[model samples]
Target: MYTISDYLLDLLNYLNVKDVLGVPGDYNLSFLDHITRRSDMKWRGNMNELNAAYMADGYARQNGMAVLVTTFGVGELSAVNGLSGSQAEKVPVLEIVGTPTLAAQYDQKLIHHSLGDGNFEHFQNVHKELGFKVEAITKDDAISEINQVVKYVYENKQPGYLALPVDLTEMPVNPIFKQLIPSLFRNKNEPHDHLQNIEAISNQLKNSHHPILIIGEDVQRFHLQDVVRNFIINNDIPFADMIESKGIIDETLPQFIGTYNGSLSKDLTNQLINKSDLILLLGAILTDANTGGFTQSFNSQNTIDINAKRINFYSKIINYNEQNGFVNLIKIISQTSLSQSFPKGPHDSINNKLPVPSDKPITQDFYTSAMSNFIQSDDTVIAEQGTSLFALEQIKFPANVKFICQPLWSSIGFSFPATLGSQLANPKRRNVLSIGEGSLLMTIQEMGFAVKYDLKPIIFVIDNHGYSVERVIHGMHEPYNDVPALNYSLIPEAFGAKKNQYNYFDVRTEKELLMAMKSIENNSSQLSIVRVSMAASDAPEDLKEFGKIIAKQNKG
Candidate 1:
C-alpha cells in the first residue's frame, strides 16, 4: 500500500512533468524533499513566488505545459498575481499549492501566520476570479484527481491547480490510481449558431478587395502556425500579429507587417486594414486594448472573426473548432483567390525595408542596432517591456532562434526569471533580455538565480528610469523617465557571478556601443548589463483627444 504523496509523484510522471517552479518553506519541506530526490522531476529555483508564477506563465507560453509549486497562504497568494496575469493572457499554468498538513490544519490556538480558518477557502475561491480550474487534493484521491487536473489544464489552455496538504506530500502511492489514464480532450462549448456565422463570413469574403489576414496565439496553441502561414502566403495577404502572435510568420517576411498593437505601428497597417474591403481575422480576438478599445481604427467593409469563441463582429459571430465550421469558408476563398500578385519570398518593397542605420539621437532604432550587433543569429532573444519593447520591434529574428517576450500582459520586470526558465527549457540557447532599470528592481533577486547556477545571459538594462510608458501617456514625459544609473558592471562581483565570466559596460554613443558588443562575443557563463540611456518621446500617435474626452466626462 503506497502513501498518498508517492501516488502524487507517480501522477506527475504520468503527465510527463519534468520541472515545477516555486520556492520551498518549512510547510512544504517534506514534499520538496520527496520530489527533490526523484530524478524525474526537478524544482526550478525561484527568488520570489510572484516571479515564479510569471516564469511558469512564460514556460507555459513556450513549452505549452508549465507547473508551479508554492507554499500555503502567503506563498500561494504571492503567486496569484502572476497566475492572474497568465489567465488574462490565456496562458496555461498548473499551480501546485502546498497546504498545511491535515495533521496540523486545525488551529486549536493562534498559529504562526494563518490568513483564515486554515481551510484555504480564500485560496481556492481566488481561482473563480482567475478563471482556472482549482482542486484540493486529499491523501486518498492523489492519482485520479491529479490526473484529471492535468488533462483539463492541457485542453483548456488555462491555468490548473492542485492544492496539496502537507500530509499528502509524504503519503504513499494509491494502488487504484495505477490503473488510471487521463484523456487530453477538453469539454467543448459550442456557440449557439456557429455554422450560420461561418456561412455569413464566407459571403463577406467572397465579395471583397485587399482581403488581409491575421492569426493570433490560439493558432500557436493548436499547432496551426504552419497551416495559417501557408494559407496567408498562398493568399498573398500582408499580415500582422497581436503581441502574442510573434513567430506566426517569419517576422522577417516582406509580406509580414509585424504586430498591430500598443507601441506597434498602426501607420500603413492601420491604413491597409481600414481600407481593405474584407479582413479575415483568424484566431485573433478583438480585445479593446489590442484594437485601441475597438475604436475607429477599424474601417474595413467586413470583419470576419475565427476564434476559440463566438465573437460578435460586423453583425456576425463565428466560432469554429479546428476548422470544423471553417472548411466551407476556406473552400469559397480557395476558389476566388487573387493573392498571386504577391511574391513568395521576402520583401523588396521600399516601404517595408528595415530602417537604415541612423545617427538619429535616442530612437528605438538606436537600441535595436545595439542589440542586433551583439545578437548572434544562433542566440535566442528574450525581451522585456518599455525600451526593450522598442528595441526588439525592429530586430530581425535569426534561424533556429526563438524570441521570448511577455507581450500579452506586458507586465514589467517579466523577462528576468522568464529568461531563467527559458535557459532551463533549452540549455543550448543563449539568453538575452532588455529591461528598464526600475522594472528590473521589481525582482532583481532573480539575477541571483543566474549566480546560483551560473546560468549566464547577456542582460542589457535600458536605464530609462521609471515607468516610461506611464510618464509618456499621462504625466511629464522627460525628467520623469530619468532614474539614477548604477554601475551595473559590479553586478558580477556583487552576485557571486563566476570570476572573469562576466563583464559590464555603458553605452551612450555609437562607438562605445559597438566596442561593448564586440567584447561580449565568445564569452561564457556571464551576466552583462549594457546600460542604454532613455530619452522621453511620444507614442506613434498620442491619444490626447481620447484621453481628454474621457477626462472631461469624468470631471462632469
Candidate 2:
C-alpha cells in the first residue's frame, strides 16, 4: 500500500532529511498527514511560507540539502523571495507545491489557490522564470517527475519545483516503481582534458613566487574544505575567505590571512592580495558584496578561477561537464608538488577579555568587539544582512565555527528563521543569532517556532531604534527609515516560552551587556534574548563605506 506520498517521503528520508518545513494550507492538508505519520521525518510548520523557505535554505546550508513544502499560488508566492535567495546563493532546496487536483486542472476550473482566470499553470510558470527546474506532476508521471526534480536540485545545488496535485497523494504507485533507485545517469568519469587543465594549473602554481588562494562558498557546498586546506598547508600558501564563504575553512589557522573585501579589507589583507603574482580562486564567486562592491583590483592574467562547471585560467576557458570537476581539480592540485614560501599575515588573536562593566552605553564598535569574544568554537553564528553582518566582518571566528548570512542576497529578516533551521539540523551545537531590530521585525513570528521545538539559541537583538543600514545608504534623517518601536524582551514569553524555558535581558550599557552574556552562559540550556540599544548613526566603518557605494550605484 505504498502511495505517492510515501514514495516522496521515502526518497527524502533516504536523502537524510529528518524534517520537512512548510506552512500548511487546505490544498496541502492531505499530504501533510503523510509527513505527520512518518516516524523518520517530522513536519515542522512555520508561521508563514517565507520563513519556511528560509529555514529550508538554512537547513540545506548545514545539512547538505533541504525540502520545502507549500500550497500553491499564495503560499508558493510568499516563499518565492526565500527561494530566490537560495538560488542566488546556490543552496539546494526542493520546493513541493501542493496544487489543485488533477481533475480541476484538466477541466480548467477556477480554484481558490489558482488565478481567477482558471489558469492553474500560472504559478508554476512564475517559479520557472526564477530558474527553478519546475514540473507539474500527474498520476502517470509522479514517480519519474519526483525523482527528476529531486535529482536536478541535488546535483545542481539550486532550487527545484514540483507541483503535486492534491488528488495524487493517496494514489497507489506501481509495484515495479516501489523500489526507488539512485540516478543511473550520473557520470563519474573525469571530464574531457582533465589532466591537461590540472597540469596547466600546476605549472602556473609552481612557477609563481607568491600565489594566494581565495576560497569561496562553493568550497563548502561541494565539501572540499579538507582538500582545500591540505592544498593550502602543503603548498605553504596564504589564503583568505570571502564574506559569503566566511568560516568555510577554520579562520584560526595561522596561514589563514583575513577576509578579503576589495578596498574595505584590512590593510595587510589588501596588500597581500594586491601583491600576489598568481591568485587561485577555488570555488569562489566574485559577487559585488564579496568583492566589496566590486572594488577588487587584481591582474586578470595572473588569476585562475575554478568553479563547479568551468575553469578559467588567465583568459583561456575550459568548460567541464561533470559536477565533480571542482572536487577532482582540488584533489589533484593538492597532490601536486608546488610548494611555495610566503609570509604569514598578522592574525587577529581572539580577544577573551570581557568589557569592563561601565554605565557607558554600548556603541556599535564596542558591541562588535565583545561579540568577537563571546562566540565559541563549533557554534553556528547567523547574522542579519545589516549591521549584524558588518559587525561580524571584524570578528575572527574560532575554529569550526559555522557562519551563516545572506551577504550575496543582502536580504533582511533572513537570519532569524535561518537560525532555527541550522539549529534543528545540528541540535548539538549552540546557535547564536545576531540580528538588528529592523531585520528581526520582518520575521519575528519564527521565535514561536523556536520555542515550540524547545531549541536553545542565544539571540542578540541589536535595537538601534530603526533601519540603520538604510540611514547610511541614503536619507540619514528620513522618517521612511524608521521602524515601529516594540518591546523585544517580551517576545519570547508571548511566543509561549515558559519562564523556566527562556531568559530575556534588556542591556543598554557595556556592564549590562556583559551581565546578560554571563547569565546566558550559565543557563546554556534555555533560550536567551539580549536586546542591546545603540545609536542610529553608529555603524562599522566597513558598513558605512559599503553603503555609500551601494547608494551611488543605486543613483546611477
Candidate 3:
C-alpha cells in the first residue's frame, strides 16, 4: 500500500527535487527509509541538522525549491538559524519535521527530543515566528495540507514547516493520492488596470532622459533573469545590480554599469543612479547590505518598484492576482516603446589583471585582484560573510558564473555546507568556496560529508587570525577577536579524504599563493583546500568603512 511518506516524496519529485537533504534522527528514520527506497529521490545525509538546513537553503537557491527533514524539538531547533536565513533572503525551502506519534503528543507524553514540559507545538510555533507557513499533518488532511504547504513555499519563495508524526509515515493512503498534484503555476489573467499601469510606466520611461534599471535577489529567486536581461537589451537601458543579486545577469554586458551598493557604489554608478529622472527597481528588496547600510536615496516620485505580488508606480500601488504578474508586467513593459535612445553609455568594467607574484606577504588587495583573474566563466563562487565577501565584491565575475552568499543573515559558517548543496544542485559547474578561518571552525565537519560524496570543490580558507570583521568594528586588539590556529593541511585526511581525492596547500607569501592557485587550476578534478595566511589587521577597505557604520549604529 502507498504511504503518506511515499506520496509526499512523489509530490516533491514533481517539483524537481531529485535529492533530499537532512540528518537522520530516530524519529525520522522510517521516512528516510522511504526516501531511500525511491529511485527518483536519493537521500543525502548531512553532518548535523544546522548544516543540513544550510544545505537546503543553498539547494533551494539553485534548485527552485528544497526539502529538509529533521526530527522534532532538538533537530528542528538546531536548524532554525539556517531556516531564518532562508526566510530573510526569500528562498523557498520546505522543512519536514518528524515528531512523536500522534497518540503520544495528544497524551502529552514526554518524548526524547521534546522539552520536559511535554509541549510538542513549541518548536512549530518557533518556526511560525520566523515567517514559515506552518501546518501539522494528519491522515485526514495530509494530502491537502502537503499540497498547500508545498505550493505556498514554491510560489511565495518563502520557507514552510510541516510536522509529521512518526506513526503517520506508515499510515495507508488512497491510491488516488499517488498521482502527482497539478502544477503549481497559476493561469495568467491580467488585472483590470494592468494595461493602464503598463502604459503609464512606458510613458514615464519614454519621457525620461536618464533612466536606470536596478535588479535584485528576487529576480533570481523568481527565475526572471532572462526576461530582465531581454528588457535591458531591448530598451538599450543601462542597468546596475545590487550586491545581494550579483551575477543574476551577465556582468560582461556593455549595458551593465556596475554593482550599486548605495553610497558604497562606484563613483560613476552612484552618479548615474542619483541623477536618473526615472529609476526602475525590479525585484530589489533594498536591505541594509544591499543599500550600503541603508544609504540608498531614491525618491518614490521618480521610482517604479516592481515586486512579486504588487507594483508601486511612482507613489501609487497596484496589486495583481496572477502569480506571474511580475513576469507579465516586465514582458509587457519590454514590448512597449519605452525609450527612444540610450540614457547613458556603460562605464568601463573592472580591470581583472593578474598581479605579478613577489616574495612579499599576501595582502587583501593583492588577493582580491588575483582571485578576480582566477575566476572563470560558469564557476559557482560561494563567499562567506566578512572578509571573503568584501574581497569578492571587488572581483569581476565572468558570464554565467553564480555568486552565492548570506549577506542578509550574515551567518559566518554558512558557505561551507552551502557549497556542498550548490554543487549537488548543479554538479556540472565548478564550486569554489571562500571562507574565513573563524567561520570554517563552526561547520568544518561538513568537509567530511564532501569527502564522503567524492565531490570536488576548490576551498579557500583565509587564515586572517580571527573575527577580523568584528575587530574592525570595535575590538581591534581585544582577545575576543582571536581564534585558535589549525593545521589546515591535515584537515582533508582527518575528514577521510585520500590523497588522490583532494589536495591541500598552505601559503603565506604571494609566490606560494599563486603557485597553489595555478596547481589547483591544473588539477581541477580533485577537491583542493588552500589555507592562505595573512595578518590579522589586514581587511578590505570597504569592510572597514562598513564596520564603522555598523559600530556607530550599534552605539546609537
Model 3, span 175-220: residue lDDT tens: 7765546544545465644887888888888898989889888888
By lDDT: ranked, best first: 2, 3, 1
Question: Which model, 1 or 3, shows the larger lDDT?
Answer: 3
| Model 1: per-residue Cα lDDT at residue 189 | 47
TM-score versus the correct structure, for each prediction? 0.83, 0.97, 0.96
Model 1 clash tally, residue pairs? 10
How high a TM-score does candidate 3 get?
A: 0.96
User: How far does residue 207 in candidate 2 sit from its true spot (Å)?
Assistant: 0.8
**Model 1 over residues 1-556: C-alpha lDDT tens digits?**
4666666666656655677788887667777776778788887778889989887876766677788888877888888888877776667788888777666765533344466455546768887666778878875665667777777677667788788877766566647665554432333544433455545555665555566676666676655666666666676667776655655556665677546653334455556555666666776766643554345355433666665554546755434544233433343333444523532233222222333443444445555655655665556677776556645654445543566766557678778888777776566777777777878877788777777766777787766556665554456456655556666767667777766666778776656666677777756556677776656553213233333333445465
lDDT of 2 by residue, 440-517 (tens): 999999989999999898999999888998999998889999999998768888999898998889999998998888
Q: Give the clashing pairs for model 3.
A: none
Please estimate how well model 3 matches the true structure, expressed as its whole-model Cα lDDT. 0.86
